[model samples]
Target: MHNHGAVGLPLGFTLLRLILLGAVTVVAGWALVRPFVPAASGLLTRRVVTGFAGIGGVVVLLIAEATWMPSLAAVALIGLLAVPPALRGARPVLGKLVVAAAVLVTAAAGAWFSGPPSSFAYITLMAAFVGVSWLALCPPTAMVRVVGAALGVTLLAGLGQVTIAGQLTTPATGDPLLTRVALGPSPVDVLVVPHMPGWNIVHTTDTPLSVGNAPNALVPALPRDGTTGRWALVWLPEGRGELWLDRAGTRTTVPVDPGKVAWTGPDVRGPEGPDYASAVLAAKLTGKRGDLPWPALTDADAEALRGQVAAIGGPFTVLTDDSRRAAEAAEVVREEAARRGYAVTPGTSEVLVLGGTPPSGARHHLAPWLVPPDLTTPEARRYARTLSAAFPGAAPSRSGLAAWAG
Candidate 1:
């Protein structure tokens, strides 16, 4: 999914370009080959070369799944070349069937393996061969004319249905689902800010920089205008509202209301005291505010937050994916928690089983890396065996064990 250097083209546009280019090339090639076919009827060179070219084109199409070779121009060229073999005089019976079967099979195999884009591109090639074969094999009579007319009508109907279906299924421009996670070609410069106490908000580029992902995550370049040190207050999942409040001397919690505007006090003791400024931020930033009103919190809310932090004892642990960092973070959290009368044990095991579910009031968010069970490797397997022997059934999950040690 993370194709670092992947290039993309709209599926319909790519197919159109392929067909237009192929038509031009095919027309030009036919003009050159028409006169020579009569004079060189017995030569094997033309047959051999055409067969090789057709086979090579099929191979190229299959490989295009992982590579961008035989660009649109090449596809047109090969499709154009196929027209001649298809038009070569009337065949007895078996020879015609063999050619038709081979071409169909080759085209199908190439299309199936070439990813959706390439598969669609080769449809034109298939159509060209089928049409040319029918024209060459049948006599210029009423039956052939009737069959062609029927096929044309059927194709037009099918095309009309497909077009209508496409329009209906397509989302409008502003629809959220149609938009990708972030805008533009460049990756968003995410600033994750987890609600870690005392730590000056850790910043990382890892995506989904919302709650449970980053520590005090901020929007990229929000402080360009130094006059106002503006930081967007974000609401975490489970109706949790957070703000970065640092006043000149007296910093106090902004009363966030789920039904009204969130109140934040200005730095000075003068005018901006109780007349707080508030607005409805993004839902992801404000949890689910649509059903509720704003001025989002009350004094009771501040008391509730205090109680939650008190129950947690203090300080959230931050564990990075790196073993060295996790180990270091674990040591810090363990020491700090123990000092605050909460028992703490830290280990680099594949699994962690806390004695109870995280306390409701506790702001106890584990570092991102610690959320998932670690995998066990040879070194890990040895460690897990020792740990499990000491504490039975304390081993990591089976999948994690396999991924870690395998």
Candidate 2:
């Protein structure tokens, strides 16, 4: 599955988060500056400082409850707003209280959101360290000169815990966990001729199957033996093209000859065989020969086609002749389109006709190939029978029905 990136937060929440972050940064800068400035400077009165501290405390609580990572824009804004206050300084008893209260509030918030950091003993130790440091900084202590040294160790420890937790929990940038492609026999054989070195073909005993990152380029499971652990059962276009295998965010490309890869059936050989009727059907459905399209109507292809039609945002119609195969193919197309919110209205200007003459004013057409009488191979006959069973109606031609085996 593809990672399309994170969804944006709502505008009101984002604005509120920014406001809270700004308040926290300002209050933090003031507290950092408070240790050096003199009282005679009169930069801030105790009354005003206490009021701002209260506001900052409320904002911190809100931020803790929300628990959102600050965006780059918010960080930049905070940095710019912090410069002036950080440069200025003051030494006030109330300033120490403000900083200590902020720290305690933050710790309380962390405990409420995340479970308590480590254990009860660790928590008690941290609290003791904080209390000792606060006592060293307060006016009653002779250790005021050594307050910075006391807090520095505790600050470093907290930073270490944050850094380690972030590293352990977060995946490296641009590196995502990939779902490994299952190894074993599949409906269509995919020949891997590595264009680069350092690649080895491996096998697994996993059941069912996984399409990995190339869901649209292959069919699911169909019984085929003798290819269990050697060859990967994937389908590519019939020619020399690049085949990519992605594992652990690294992609390995290999050149392949798709003509050598065989489909599952008695009469159906590889794409090079004459009776490879599946390829013919895929070509008709996708309007592309021997490229990307598999020899079947895969779910990926259906969804892709639906997305394309939905993107157009216009009305269209699906038409088919009296032939059973043509009607079956048309129904498949109509159903897929409908699933993507594309309605099939009658007499729409855009019409997709299968094995039938386009009605008047029709703009789009997908005519099927008429099977020649001499082209009566076992594979072709099998396709005909499958079509007849899908839609039982008056047959179209004497030679055969439209090919719709997939």
lDDT, each prediction: 0.32, 0.35
TM-scores of all predicted structures: 0.28, 0.25
Off by over 4 Å in 2: 1-9, 40-44, 66-406
Candidate 1 lDDT score relative to the true structure: 0.32
lDDT of 2 by residue, 298-327 (tens): 454445445546554777877665444455
Which predicted model would earn the best lDDT?
Answer: 2
lDDT of 2 at 21: 41
Q: Give, for candidate 1, the lowest lDDT window spanning 10 residues.
A: 172-181
Output the TM-score of candidate 1: 0.28
How high is the lDDT of residue 204 in model 1?
19
